[model samples]
Target: MNITPKWWHDAVVYQIYPRSYCDSNNDGMGDLRGIISKLDYLKTLGVNVIWLSPVYQSPMDDNGYDISDYQDIAPMFGTMADMDELLAEAKQRDIRIIMDLVVNHTSDEHPWFKEARKSKDNPYRDYYIWRQPNEDGGVPDEMGSVFGGTAWEFDEQTGEYFLHIFSKRQPDLNWENPKVQEEVHKMMNWWIDKGIGGFRLDVIDLIGKEIDKKITGNGPRLHTLIQEMNRATFGDKDVLTVGETWDATPEIAKLYSNPARDEFSMVFQFEHISLTWQHGDKWSPIPLDLPALKRVLTKWQVELADEGWNSLFWNNHDLPRIVSKYGCEGEYRVPSAKMLATTLHMMKGTPYVFQGEEIGMTNVAFPSIDDYRDIETLNFYKVRTENGVSPEDQLAAIHVNSRDNARTPMQWDDSANGGFSDAQPWINVNPNYTHINVAQALDDPNSIFYHYQHLIALRKAMPVIVYGSFEPVFEDHPAVFGYVRANDDVRVLVLSNFTRESVTVDLPESLQAEQVECLISNYTAPSTLAQTVTLQPYESFAVVLPA
Candidate 1:
């Protein structure tokens, strides 16, 4: 963008799931040292930021999300010295590091929670949410955890239930308590002073819940709490903050991300990604409603353009791979991935590239349930089976929608453990890694990796790609999606075929042939415009149009 460098506004963030990125110690788990070993690779990808998933000390109950110690590095990921070295190395390459901040809850193993459960009179009891059992000795509220069952966990010693919206090991923190907020702020400031760039707040919106009403998000004091958080911790620093607001509407998102307010630089909204699920349930798969997806995204693009900003992503540690969910992973894997990247990268926001996304990683179908490691997936399997869902059916759902799908180790080459580790990986590497690995992509000029490099380069070279206003085109079309982004000097048209079948669109008469200049495309086509144009399966093209 022509605007002064606000780093976050124009930067591409590459997310690394520490357990799956690479294993430097041959322990089969990715670590801070593994990330340090790949700094040059990130530099080559042209991404200016790296968002590492939680490396904080944890019990691994919910992977790294259950933080036992926010200040200490998790032994599985490596030492604090390793993290310091990683930060220095990344900075040397002009890449900023954004850490995953899981403050909504802490592991029960945390000193605060450990003491809180000892007795009702314990000094640390107020650090967590504990409630007396209901009249019927049931949960204190009607809310269900995101992982299923009641959101309340009964602690035998205290004879009170603690709220955990995730796993029981992860008890929600009492943000209403000033002491808790102070502890969170102190920890954040310590990280900032340690030279960390920013934070990706985990389940940030859920932190402000009303116990009586059982509302998990957009609670009464959510905005006030975030505002105070900013003023206390990150307000003075030049840092990036992104909150994971799973159920946030556009209006709610604006509140968290508006620049006028000292909350966050942007928020990750889940509306578009949740389109294919029935009744907002990830396990319930249905046909993807393309028009609805476009509508939700367009609303965010329009509503957040002025006051707030958006965090663009298709895959993350908690979701399935992009190609498997939205694109054809079997026959049209390469082109489909490039198409997905072009669509998201060309949007009006900061784009995030999840680990292995650039090289076209696809989801895995582990032959048996034992192959899965994610607690969420395993929990779903147990619950679904008890509810009479057939084993085959449960496996089908997990294969298509498990978070583990995105947790597979990064495939660097075709060698053993996909060159990720000399030992067997914590999770099996996708067998397709032999062909879809980064080494193969680097050697092949037309690989998805190169396409992503081109896309990142275009964002850096063209200001319009970063600052242009977005307007949806062919909003009602099912198989083909199109949009235009324009600035004072240039307007760019992005068109993609979302299906494996050829699709055609009637070009608007306003798009003159003389003004069209090809910028990027997954497949070669004539630059000249026609009244109607056909797109091959999974083809995507972007062109500079007359402004």
Candidate 2:
């Protein structure tokens, strides 16, 4: 059953936010050499693929997402030789490398943009989206940047406005231009030719904008354009390409990830990540909904049952730490984190591990907004501050949910700079490293790190959790969250108590197996009402029964 055709189906992809992972040169920044040094660590985590964030030559306008050059590594990361060494080292460790492909935009400092912005009549002018100002001398659409400010920025040199969905320093590339498309394909092939097996496409859905019609938001163009990419550089390459697509409907997700669709292998969706935000803006919300979380997972469960693949995860570079955002990381940190891991990975899809996630890293609580560095976080703070927003409350909310929440230097150990750097880190290491470092978690058998190892091993050992169809077992029950995954020879029953009080999970008529083996359990709630079993607070159980 060691099939290679479907390696991705059974693969574990670990996402490494390079700047925060490790720094080897004492430059206060993580580099390719640092990643090379940690291949063995990633290998020990049981992940087969490493999805690295952008490492291309850039101005770091958006943390390398705004690529200035597609062909080489940024000076901060290392030279091209260093990248090759890291790639070879990772491959030697049996880990495939997935580079982040930020094709939607290029750095404004890019030679192409520099030349293009010289004049509207330049050959490279059409390489980006440039439009004549409207009758009112304003940008045509009231398009909003995900970061902040107007999506269109006026360029005095060109006497035209250029579109930037992100930072003004990053201009959206015109995918409709054949030359632009060809250049991107060539760049992608160069990476693949350099031995990369896959790509984690950044803002990939934003490619192929509708000409003449201004793109207001996430629409169908995201899908139809990806079709072009799959057809071009990645055609029949036996590779992986995931899109950072938010607000895509379930049907759209299938269209993007369906094997036959030829769009992408999988894409990152943002629906589940929104649960942590419950207030003014989705970013710094006040409340979280656990029951609604189960509902979100349920939709994906049915949406991708036999059609598409889901990228299962809790934390990544964009959102706050999983430990802080999801489960009550303070009160029931151990069981809650453990149960949350069990809750997601055991579902039907490929599991993506964020860096430092295996060690249960939580979000940081900054004493002042001055400590924050993320552009998105700063934009929100500045705008709210200018609007007469309370400086104290804004800083408090930011402490709860800043992108820097996930960007703090990784805690490798309790040593200097959390063992992540020989020099001062670009960002301060979380002060709780003494209590939550990898060294401490790995040493404790019942720690969150160990729980992740158990879940990963079980997923690889049992296809019922990997390839089996996902069916929510106790869907109608409010307190009980359970599911069943049945492969040919195995039926895995996963039941969790998401509530503070114990809840009973009744046995299904088809679940006739009287005996159940407890693969893992954090707590136990009684099921005396149905004469079956109950689960304890924040506890999760994985039982193997007869098919």
Candidate 3:
């Protein structure tokens, strides 16, 4: 395989969860106008691409992930006109907007699903995965939904059970149906024609599932369908397509991302993020294993160096804030946040900065279960409480692991609701927003926002940052993470102290260079490289060395 340069190869993407980004209207929910107002802010942040979460017409069952209309914008989020203006504004700023594609499932309220549930013989009935009841007249299978409860939902009118890997309201599409595949391809092309940047395909791997065989993801026909979808849709266009495949292994990712495969530009593999999930259970939280995290990330960086691509990210709309997860949110918040950003942004991939992450956003701990809005959090609360888990214990876990932690309103200033909205926000704003906000970060030169801006600038200026080969450094160090990126012209060494204490590591002779210059750091770096150096608590720095 040969490397082909793509526009997105050097671009930095910023993700905006519109519902929490900003609210121009006092309707308590974010709208398209809200995002339009922030276009300047995003531009100032130096991001080239904006990954907008789903805004399609929906029942809001899963916060727009369950789509009812693929072609229309949700009324609560504004009209199609508002969307057009946003696209125009973003394009004018040289920032491409990539919309979320959630074709794995559609809202139960969708016209197709509504008609399909009406009768077994409905033409759209086959659009979804439906199976007859077993001999005992029970569900078709024992599979369970990702949001809890049985995966199969029985339809009284059709006398059949439909597979729903997520919430029941989100019925999975039957990709095996050629008609369904055709409709998906058509929808994708429609979006492409609209001049949108690309797509962040949600749970795309699940589309090729073999329900009867209990294969939920990375199924046998997954690559086949993806290749066909690519050829029929955006393959010929200069657009980025990243599939959300939680089950993608490094080898499998190659099939999805290798240019010859004619599939996606990349896939968001969760191997590194899953390190914090104890025994593969999300609710069972554990401390961030720095060594394991390093190993996983290093593996992806090395394995995908030749044929595939990688999407580097820490927190998104569905995970806890990184400053609060892997870094301390207390005294070392600023430096730690910068450290995390430095570590990820310097890697060999397209780095994504989630909304509010550049401002050092921390996780929120709502006082009560009623305060939470995520279906997954609420379901887990009820189930755990019923299963002998105390409310306090569950809430404790929710503090560290709930998806709601990342959904709080963006902290724009010290004003009420963090200046996100004039009226009450749909969700509570983080109380600490008064101190940690975009306004404060903008005023301070040493803020995390500036750090991110600098990193984005570096990527655009330095070819080595975008195409360098990754080599692990201090791989066994428990409290320190370090890596070297090298190309024919330059070698860059990035190091971060993960713990809240000073750590000293000896430089390997192979990595030692006579000529070294500090490229960027959270702290004032030394003038020259040494055989050994000490890193302060939560400190991170990148240095350019002779190749």
Q: Write the per-residue lDDT of candidate 1 for residues 266-286, one digit (tens) a residue.
A: 999998888888897788878
Q: What is the TM-score of each candidate against the true structure?
A: 0.98, 0.94, 0.99
lDDT tens digits, residue span 439-544, model 3: 9999999899999999999999999999989999899899999998989888889999999999988998876766678889999975677788899999999999
lDDT of each: 0.90, 0.81, 0.92
Model 1 score (lDDT): 0.90
Better structure of 1 and 2 per lDDT: 1
Leading candidate by TM-score = 3
Assess the local accuracy of residue 185 in candidate 2 as a C-alpha lDDT between 0 and 100. 82
Q: Where's the lowest-lDDT run of ten residues in candidate 1?
A: 1-10
For lDDT, candidate 2 versus 3, the one ahead is 3
Model 1 RMSD, rounded to 1 decimal: 1.5
Which candidate comes out best when scored by lDDT? Answer: 3
Candidate 2 per-residue lDDT, tens place, 1-547, comes to 2223377877888999999998989899999999998888777778889998999999887888888999988999999999999889988888899998888889998999999999878999999998889999999678878887788999999789998989999998987788988898888888888888799988776784674566534554666667777788887797888888876668878888887877888778888787666643754575666577778889987887777788898888888887777666677878878888888888988899898888888889878777777888889888888988788888887877788988999898889889988888877888988888888987888888878888888878877777787778777677667888787887777887776676766586776465666677676422222337667777887777754
Whole-model alpha-carbon lDDT for candidate 3: 0.92
Per-residue lDDT, model 2, residue 403, is: 85
Q: Please say which candidate is ahead in lDDT: 1 or 3.
A: 3
